[model samples]
Target: MGGLHADHAKPDDRPTGLPTSSATLTPLVVKMLRHGRIAAEHDLLDIGTGAGGLTAIAATRLGSDRVTSVDIDGYLVDAARDRLAGMGLSPHFVTQDATDALPGDYDRIVATVSARPVPVSWLQALRRGGRLVTTIADTALILTAWKTPDGGATGVIERDWAGFMTTRHGSAYPPGLDELFETAREADGENVKLFRYPVTDIRNNWEVWSMLTISIPGIEVDFEETPEGRTAWLAHPDGSWARAEATKFEPPTVHQSGPRRLWSELESIRNWREVEGGLPLYGCRAVVTPDGAIHLSRGRWSATIG
Candidate 1:
């Protein structure tokens, strides 16, 4: 279950699969494509052409002319194009950042990669009432929205969850939270206390990870098993870091420091979830403002995906 779950690493926060980024799992690909409600007449723009599996399937089902796949890496786009050509499929392929100006009007846009906020550019390129299926960066919430006439979008957080590497503007991603993690690896920290809730394995706990990610964006997670016990580290770009150490059948000792108490924040989210019965991400209705700010609301609970 933990295979591709991630926050910042959304796989990139902790990469897997291909050397560059995690390709959408085949099952998830099929699920998304099906849910995408693709029609033979729909012009589809597939983002993050990793391994080209999704592109191949879409091109096959929708026909190559109806599909346009893009990736930031030219090499990936070129390679995927070649592979598809062998199968007598040639969808339009482009090598550029997905967040940039997307070319062509698309009736359906499905990104295997994640986006922080639904990019405005995407909305601009989408035809009216077009369908878009993508995941929120740093979480596993699959978003399916429709282009609204107001230049925004509205939809829902699908009942299922999936994670893809966050979209990158360049071949290499910007720096990560390495400095804070280095200190967390050893420093005792400015605040040390006992965790009220069980230590969280952000890597594996998809719901909690999604909640925390939505609550506090840019949190990166790392954990390791040692002969002594288990250690989990959470670092944020804002210089906040938390380290928890625990052994089997025992409580964790938490050490945290910085502008925010990362561990306490996680505990708070867990506690809130306990009181609320569960998170509001799944099955929640989402509205992407004309500016691309995604707002979600379900019942009386609400949260925005940044």
Candidate 2:
């Protein structure tokens, strides 16, 4: 929360040698804390302790002894320890992979970073009836569920759209899909068609971007406004790719290749929004099994992420 500005460092300015930690915005942190339903008597775990901001707030509200913080980055853990110590507050700090065994049972567990599958260890560490608040990776879907008697958890996705950096297990994330991107740049796509809709920058539209992520996981997107108009590219690790270009209020030219029609899929989602007036991602019911599979359902539509 405190280091929100620093966490948003420009991509070009970030050092290539160090893994970056994510800091949550103050407002979002408050929302997560409220959804967690933390109480003064409850024990808490602050996962992904980037800069110790959330840990500090919890310690101040719940006392230092009742809070435990863990992170994979030893460097970040050490820095957070020192920062908390400066305020005359010291909470238990453990430097380890969060997906591994955690230290203590807690009534509340809040993660500031996004996880692919609400980690299984988190469910094991939470007491029955305890709450876990977190977001899914690659999308702005916030989940807050309470552990049930049978080891599964049930809850709903928050209406707000909040995003954080994904968790990592090493010094840095694995290299990007350079080989796939390079091939997609020049490879002749199998299908070329005229796109009837005006070129839209999906990245700038949170709803469309989030829906696209759910519809096509692991897809990468890029956009640029050039003198010719707007150009956009979509690439997937499976060799699927699409390139589109168009000016304001004009239809774009689209070319796609690989096993999937990436642009057409996007257009389908856009058309669905046009018909339904919105997406079914937010405020949906979320159920998590003990094995760490998460399922979200709203009306007749449902999706699973693990």
TM-score of 1: 0.91
Q: lDDT per residue, candidate 1, 1-306, as tens digits?
A: 122322223433545333346556799899889878998899999999988999999999989899999998776777788889999999999999899998898999998888988888889989999998999988888999989999989899999988888788766666677777899999988999888665657868888998888888889998887777888999998999999988843688999989999889898878888999888779999999988888989899788765
Instruction: Specify the highest-TM-score model's number.
Output: 1
TM-score of every model? 0.91, 0.90
| Candidate 1 displacement at residue 181 in angstroms | 0.2
Candidate 2: tens digits of C-alpha lDDT, residues 1-306: 122234445756535432356667887788888888998899999998988899999999999999999998787888899999999889999999888989989999999888978888999999999999998887777889999987879999899877787777775677766676666666666898888677787876777888898878898887778777987788888878888878865888888988999999999888888899999988999999998899989999999887
Q: Which regions in candidate 1 have their CA more than 4 angstroms from the true location?
A: 1-19
Model 1 clash pairs are 7-138, 8-13, 9-12, 9-13, 9-14
Candidate with the greatest lDDT versus the true structure: 1
